[model samples]
Structure formats: C-alpha cells, structure tokens
Target chain A: MTTNPNTSTLDYAAVKPNDTRAYSVRNILSHVFALVVAGFFLYAAYGKIGPVNARQFAVQIGNYKILDAAYSNIPAIILPFIEVYAALALLFPKTRKAGAILMAGMLLFFICAVFYSAIHLGLSIDCGCTGKGGSKAGWGVIARNTGLLIATGLSVWLYQCGPCAPKTSVDS
Target chain B: MKHIFGVIVILIVSVITGVAAKAMWYDTWSPTKAAPPQKMAWVKQQTSDAIAKTGADRNQPGTSGDASEKVTDNDAEVSDSSGATDASLTADAAVSNDEPEFSGGFPVAKLDMVVDHLINGTAHFVDAREEYEFDDGHLKGAHLLPSSAIYENIENLMAVGVLPGPGKPIIVYCGGGSCEASHNVAKVMAEFDYQNIYIYVNGWEEVMAEPDRFAGQTE
Candidate 1:
C-alpha cells in the first residue's frame, strides 16, 4: 500500500503506522498562532489614518528613521492595507508562507531599528513602535520581537512538514 | 508536487490567520475601552437633557419665578468666567475627533471668541490646519503651523510673530468646525507647558460666518 510520504515527514504515526493518540497537538498550535497574528494586524490597521491623523504615526515612524516626514503620510495610508493583508494571508493555508515571510521580515526590521536606536541613538528619541504612550524601543522590544519571530518561524516550518496522514494496513 | 502544494496551502492559511488574529487582538479586543468626551452617544444624551430641562423649566408658570432666567444667569456666569464655556461645550459635542490629552482631558474653545481676541491683538492666532488647507485660506493674522508638524515646527510660530512666549494666550484652529487637527495641535502646545492654549472648536468656517467680528479675513 502506497502511503503519503509528507505525512511520515510530519512525524505523525497516524500518517505513517502504529502509534495512536486521541489527538495531535498541531491543531491547537495552529489555532493559537493564527489568533495571535490576526489580532496584531487588525489592531495596527485600526489606528492607521482612520480618525487618527497619519502624522501621528509618522512621528512614530520618524523615531526609527525608517520613514521621514515627507513619506510619513504615505505609510499611514499604506499601513491599513498591510495590516488587513497580513491578517487574511495568515488565515489561509495557501498564503501562509508568504505571510510568514513578510511578518518575519517586518519583525526583523523592527528588531534592527530598536537595537540601532538603543545603541546609537542613546534612547533619547521616542521609538514610537506602538501607541502614543509607547515607550522607546529598547532591549525589551528586541527580546519580544525575537520570541514572536521564533514562534512564527516554527509555525511556518511545522506547516511545511505537512498534516498527519492516516496510517495504512501495509505494515500489518 | 501535490504533497508540497498541500503543505504550502496549510502554511499560508496558518500565516494569514495568525496575522489577522494579531491585528484584531491589539486594535479591537485589547483596547476595547472607548476614550471619554469623544463618545457621541453620551454627548447626545447630555444635549437633550440640557435642552429639555431648560424647556420644561421655562414652560412652568409663575411662582417658579422664571426658571429660564436662572439657566441663562448660570450660562452667563460660566461664559463670563470662561468665555463661551456653554457654547464651547456644545461645540465639543459637534466633533467626535477628540485627541486624548496626555493629561486626559478634551480641549475645546469658541473660534469666534478666540478670533475676537486675536483681532483685538489680545491673543495670538495659530492655524493648526494642514499646510494645504492653510494655503487654501486661513485667518489673516493666523500663522500656519500644521498640526502634524506642531512639535517640529513650533518655533516657526515665534518666527511669524504669532506665538511670542509662554505667557501670551494662543488660539488654535484647523479647517472648519468638524476637524480635530487643531485640538491635537493645542494639546501639543499644552504639552510644551503653554498655559493658555485655547482650541477653536467652531473652527475657521464658523468664525468666518460672522464677517465683522473676525479679525483674520480669508477669501
């Protein structure tokens, strides 16, 4: 009996043979990861030039030097789309990889910005990563981003491993 | 190829869901609490209550001794003390765009009243509207310092001979009555420790309504 190779690669005996457990932990992890990512994107999109002026966000982006005053308004308008797209991408299997890659890249950029500001800028300027009350990004922000990146990376890797396939009678 | 494709699909789904969830958590579920003073529902209730109470008190016959008189008297005192305080409070109800002050208070002011002070040279007028709007038309004596760049270009107000120092009263406004950009700019001024930062809630449109009273004329 020919069986699915991807299932075996996924490390689930159901997809392979023998070992049987009532439930696999993959489903729970996927749900949790999806919830986390979706929530973040939705939140960021809300404040993006909706009622709140883009300049407020520009001031935030200014701290990182990723965007200057001239392009400040542009990012504010574009941010809402980025957030909505990122959220939808994470929910769908076909777009998950692209979403993961994009999310990871953004996180990495944020980490770099925070670290750069802390080391070179000496933290005098506001990091403006979050809301108006957002504290200057520092070592703490770097650690937080690193953890989130790892989680996203894991989700992407495990997803590639494939879903657990039901075992076949060939082994018996 | 099929297996690879399936795996890709699942991964993509996971990512899309995750990002969406993340956005929702922060923007919606996380900070569900609405800011005060900006909630239109509450403001609406207060408006009706004030108007109804005033109407009812006036409708009541003698021995009530003119209840409407008492209401106007109170309104007069508040206005005399705070210059159009009742009107400004009503104006606050007009716009839902309330920038949460760092100190947690919604700033409001009467544009017509502020402009009156500016024209009389009693107060300095600062146009907190965007550059484009200011260029289109703004009060004559009003100097343009877009709200977006209030923090960065604040010194320009001084350069324009508008905002001289900390003690001088400053009246700030953006576009028309509905815009909160001026309110945000006023907050920035307050953050800078400007004690007398007045917000022109009625804005330029309302101020321009009465031609003679306004000092800064715009086409």
Candidate 2:
C-alpha cells in the first residue's frame, strides 16, 4: 500500500524495505535536528529584536568596520527579523528546505565574519550573535557556526529524501 | 529558485513589519541623539570637590603636588617614559602606552594624564565597563555609563550631571587597554558632538593596580 509521504508519517517499509526500522529512526532524527535548529534561530532572534538590543546590535555591527553607518543600519534592522522568519519556516514541513537554505547562508556569513575578525583583524569584541552580552568572537564561535551549518545541511538533505518527499509504492 | 524568492519576500516583509512596530512603540528609530546644551553647575561642584580632595591630599606630604605642578611633572615623566613599563609593578603588568587613536577622532590619554585629570577634577570620568564590573570597583567619581546603554541614556547622563556637556572634558575608560567599550562609548559621545572627549586606554585595570593614587574603590 502506498502512503502519502507529505502527511508526516513515513511509510518506511515502502521507502526502505530491508531496513524499515532504521529508516524510521533516521526520519525521527532528522525532525529533531530541524526542530533544534529552528529553536536556535528563534532564541538568537529573541535576544536581538528589542528596541535597546537592536541599537546595541547595530553598534556591534558597526565595530566590524566593513560597512559604513548607512549600510550597517540596514542589516541591524533586518537581520533579526529574517532570523525569526527562518525559524518559523523551519518549523513548517513545506518551507523546511527554504528555511534550511536561508539558515545555511546566514551561518556561512557568520563563520566568515568570525574567522575574519578573530584571525585577520585580531579584534576581541563580542560576537554579537545573541545581541547584548554576547561572548567574544573567536575560533570557538566559528566552530559553533560550523556545527550549526552541518546540522542545517543534514536537515535539508533529510527533508528532500525522507518524509517530506513525494511517496511512491515499492511495487510500482 | 521560486522557494528562495518566496523566502526573500517573507524576510523583506518581516523587516518592514518589525521596524514599523518599533517605530510605533518606541517613538524614535534613530539610535543617536543631538548634543544637549552645556550645563556646568554640577560639573563645577564635582570638580571643586575633586580639587579640594587633591589639595588636601597634597598637604599630607606623600600626595602629589598642586594640580598644575603635578600635570607639568607628570607630563614630563609621561613624555619621557611614554612606552616604558610602569614603575608600579612587575614588567609583565606594564601599562601599555600605545593608545591608538579612536575612530571617532577623540584624543587618547595615557594612564598618568588620566590620573592627573582625575586628581585635578579637570575631566569627568565615564566608566564604560559592564554593570557588574563597575560594581566590583571603578575610578573614584566615575559615572557608570556602560557602552550598551550610552545612546539610550545620554540624556539621563546629562540630566544626572555624569555628562556635564559637550564642552566639558570627558575621560572614557573600560577594563583595559584592549577593551573596546571605552572606544565605543567615546565614539557615541563624539557623535553627539562632545568637544573634549578622551579615551583612557590603560583604563581601570591600571588605575586599580595603584589604588592609593586614585580615590573610589568599591570592590
């Protein structure tokens, strides 16, 4: 019997007949990974969106010295909300791929920025990842962003190949 | 590709909505404020008190001499030993004399000059350290204006006399020579057209190392 893959439950027997249980476990793990990433984005956005924090975040962005004040204000105003949107998108199955892509892009940007600041510039300012009182930017922040990038990539792959994919009967 | 476009659209909408909400609720969107008019009454009082304390201390034999005399003496010594290890401690803990000019165009002051200003009460001290750090200890009479809150509280700082005005000499400092909080706060003050801003590069660590020279210690 064919089961609709998009309905949330994976017909694991049809998808991977030899290892239905393993397929099911993999599917569950993928969902968990997506949820965790979504939660992370949400938490990051939460710290950065308030009136006071948004301004502080702007200042932190200014410290990078890559962008002038006019250009810096644009990201300072939009980045947190984009983070919020990405988190919401990740929570919904239909939008998971888009969310994962956006998150990966953001993580890549962050990793690059952290690497540049820590290695090239030798700046010891706060990473400003989680707004005010953020920990200093260093190799550790790069490591964390790299890990999150890996998780996001995995989630995207799982969504494309697992339950979120279209289903077809094994006999067909 | 379509999905990516959709995501971009959503993000643009979200930013607009979020900014609109901020504008509605917060009353002002700009992070900075115009420089307030100069107010010197409270500054005069604080300066007088600081001067009196310095004068009294100078009378006690071991204290530094009068403000002008000390400034001249310290200036000579600072110019001579500008980059040398401070005589106060181990070589490892030497105060850094390489005070980089702040991007905001404010002048950089060495530890001795800062201490001189503190003694003479010619400059108002603004501590840009975090609240807990300020609580632990700070330079005597230093206003706790953490960098995070400087823009929001600029007016409050002015009202409370922590910032006397644009014309008053304001010395901003933080944890150490490398700490950016002092520079950041100084930048904001400069943006507000503060005329005589100075960054105390060696900051609280150097000052606290010799507590006898400076006054307030709340650790």
- In the order shown, the candidates' DockQ scores are 0.04, 0.24
State the TM-score of the second chain for every model. Answer: 0.48, 0.57
Candidate 2: tens digits of C-alpha lDDT, residues B1-219: 978886877777787877785777444644332343234445545545644553453344543334334433332121111121111111112233343444334556676667776777767788887676777777777887776556656766677565432334578888874657777787666544343567787787787787776755323
Per-residue CA lDDT of candidate 1, range B133-204, in tens? 666777766777665455557656545544322234567776563445565566555543333456666676
Displacement of the residue B81 alpha carbon in candidate 2, Å: 35
* Number of the predicted model whose lDDT against the real structure is largest: 2
Residue-level error in angstroms, candidate 1, position A2 = 14
**lDDT: worst 10-residue window of model 1 chain A:** A14-23
Model 1, C-alpha of A97: deviation from truth (Å): 1.1
Report the lDDT tens digits of candidate 1 across residue range A92-171: 76677766776776778878888776666553334444434335467877887788788777666656554544534343
Residues A1-172 of candidate 2 have per-residue lDDT tens digits of: 3566566555756656645555566677778888888898889888777666677777777665567745776687788888988878877878887788889889999988878866787754667787765376788889888988888887767655664433444552
- iRMS per model, in Å, is 10.1, 3.2
Give the runs in model 2 whose Cα sits over 4 Å from its true position. A1-20, A164-172, B26-112, B119-124, B127-169, B174-180, B187-196, B201-219
RMSD list, candidates in order: 17.1, 9.9
